[model samples]
Target: MRTVDKTYVIKGKPETQWLLVDATDQNLGRLATKIAAYLLGKHKPTYTPGVPMGDYVVVINASRVRVHESRPETKIYYRHSMYPGGLKAISLRDMLQKHPDRVIRQAVWGMLPKNKLGRRLIKRLKIYAGQEHPHQAQNPQPVA
Candidate 1:
């Protein structure tokens, strides 16, 4: 008799959880990495690739996320339209003032898989500029 190893595959929907994170005074890169891990479900032992086994992450006070003092001036975000002379640029300080939620979103997005799965995973991340969020009904546990 020949023994063969069978790969373990998760059947049905994998269990998921809701995690709440407070961004107050949290480092931007560190916070984004943690959020990306939870969104990718790497924190779970049953993590399976190509499966949407991640958690619903709710981040509050995104505006309070911190970075190095010089980062605001040195870091510049840029985007260019397909058309000529259509480039747009914004500084980190300006981005924080305009869209604080995007700061965290873009950072975390960079850490996720840039594919269909990545798109779907990003939807589970809910970011709020202030301390309040509407996901309280989900009874999400604080993830520290």
Candidate 2:
């Protein structure tokens, strides 16, 4: 049964807003999944597929996000520069120490659609390693 809703026929774009999430002492994966949902607009009743209906998410205290004890030593992030022997790896502990924001970003990315729309949606997310964010002027509402 295919039901067409007039609301899904967006003319250009839909209303969007900024949301705030605190990552202090929160689990890395869990926090990321929550953020991904907001970025995908799954939290909204007006969500439409293949549309950039998500809201902007501002995450603070990224450096304080945590993971399981074993993961710090066992988890290894990998990347390649496209050249032979360009493979590189970094442990979770090292990643957190150097680029905490990337940790959350990658985690959330893994949960996204992995397409052009996904790329655009990711841009709407803002992350900060510290507690202070310049989005204070937006007066972003705290996510539950």
Candidate 3:
């Protein structure tokens, strides 16, 4: 009989990478799903649930992300202030126009875990409204 090892092995030297994704004409949900997967290290063979071993993701052309149907008008993002009557709501259309990068960033953020490690993972995400981003030095590989 062969014995199996079930202990968690920590990688001594993890190779981190930079990936660039173009959001032009891409569906919002679909793009978000892919970005979340990369941020969570799901695409890596040595994935560990509690470890922050994900690669850096840079999304360009976030302003061009598309939404299906009437969601642009029907979807409302709500927020409440600490004040007694500070509940505020904004339509998806407004949010996209006002802060294009935020729209996709929030979607991807929602897909990540709600913990400290998740917060750290999100820091590696960089969303740009246009094609020009300052991370050119990282030489991110384009995703097909």
Clashes of each: 0, 0, 0
State the lDDT of candidate 2 residue by residue for 1-144, as single tens digits. Answer: 998866565677788899999999899988999999999988888888888888999999999997999999999999999999999999999999999999999999999998999999999999999999999888898997
| Full ranking by TM-score | 1, 3, 2
Error of 3 at 105 (Å): 1.2
Q: lDDT: which candidate is best?
A: 1
For residues 1-144, could you state the per-residue lDDT of candidate 3 as single tens digits? Answer: 999978565568667899999999999999999999999888988888888878999999999999987899898888899899999999999998898998998899899999999899999999999999999899999996
Q: How big is the positional error of residue 126 in model 1, measured in Å on the Cα after superposition? A: 0.4
lDDT of 1 at 45: 86
How far out, in Å, is residue 139 in model 1? 1.2
Reference-based TM-score of each model: 0.93, 0.91, 0.93
lDDT of 2: 0.92
State the local distance difference test value for candidate 1.
0.94
- Least accurate stretch of 10 residues (summed lDDT) in model 3? 7-16
Candidate number that wins on TM-score, 1 or 2? 1
lDDT of 1 by residue, 1-144 (tens): 999987667989888889999999999999999999999998988888878889999999999999999999999999999799999999999999999999999999999999999999999999999989998889999997
